[model samples]
Target: MGRLIRPDGLAVGERVRFDGQVRLVLAVTGRSVTLSDIGGTPRAVPPALLFANGDFEVVDSSGRMPLPPVSLLETLPQAALERALWWEGHILEVLNGLPPDAEAGTEPKPQYAPSRSL
Candidate 1:
């Protein structure tokens, strides 16, 4: 229903929805991508899974991505970064009645919980 973005098009700090939560792209390599939720817990995944999983979609993206903090080119502003994380927490709370990445929340739907389904 909207423009589809390929895995290779993802950029660090971009917000995406996957696995029933908001996540941020931490790093992207030719073979894999590192993603983190609002809690900053990182997960490394093969690039193809980002789109193949069918739950993946870019939520927020600017035409240009800022350089990682280690880079000298440019860094994302603290305010903007905070805003993204803030939204993740807010979304999680609204969806599950718990804080972002909290240990306890509403049980995930069988379709969304891989171990509970196929």
Candidate 2:
């Protein structure tokens, strides 16, 4: 079993939520965190704004969480966010049943359609 990662413990290539957007951890330092969107583009937000009221999560890549929902826009795309949330809800259901091995459906990745050239 692997431990879940969190924002304060982020690493290179890991994901973190800022405002409603999901940003990957490009670099971390003693003073601030630098982030990029799912499309691998740098955002213009001040590094300190990450502390604002919003949900933060470390995108799991252990093959269980296929929908890592790391967005770049100020507000994540509604459809993409919904898909990620639905997968999370299913996870909760399995945890409550104690049948941890029960596999979740092979859902498509929750990333939004890219609007720019990478």
Which 10 consecutive residues of model 2 have the lowest summed lDDT? 109-118
Supply every candidate's count of residue pairs whose N, Cα or C atoms clash at under 3 angstroms.
0, 1
lDDT of 1 by residue, 88-110 (tens): 56644554445546666466554
Residue-level lDDT of model 2, residues 6-101, one tens digit each, is: 344545556667657766666667666777665555664444455443565565423333234444322667886777666666653453432234
- Every model: Cα RMSD to truth: 14.4, 13.9
Q: Which stretches of candidate 2 lie over 4 Å from their true place?
A: 1-8, 38-41, 44-48, 61-118
lDDT of 1: 0.64
Where is model 1 more than 4 Å wrong at Cα? Answer: 1-8, 63-118
**What TM-score does candidate 2 reach?**
0.36
Candidate 2 residue 7 Cα shift, in angstroms, is 4.4
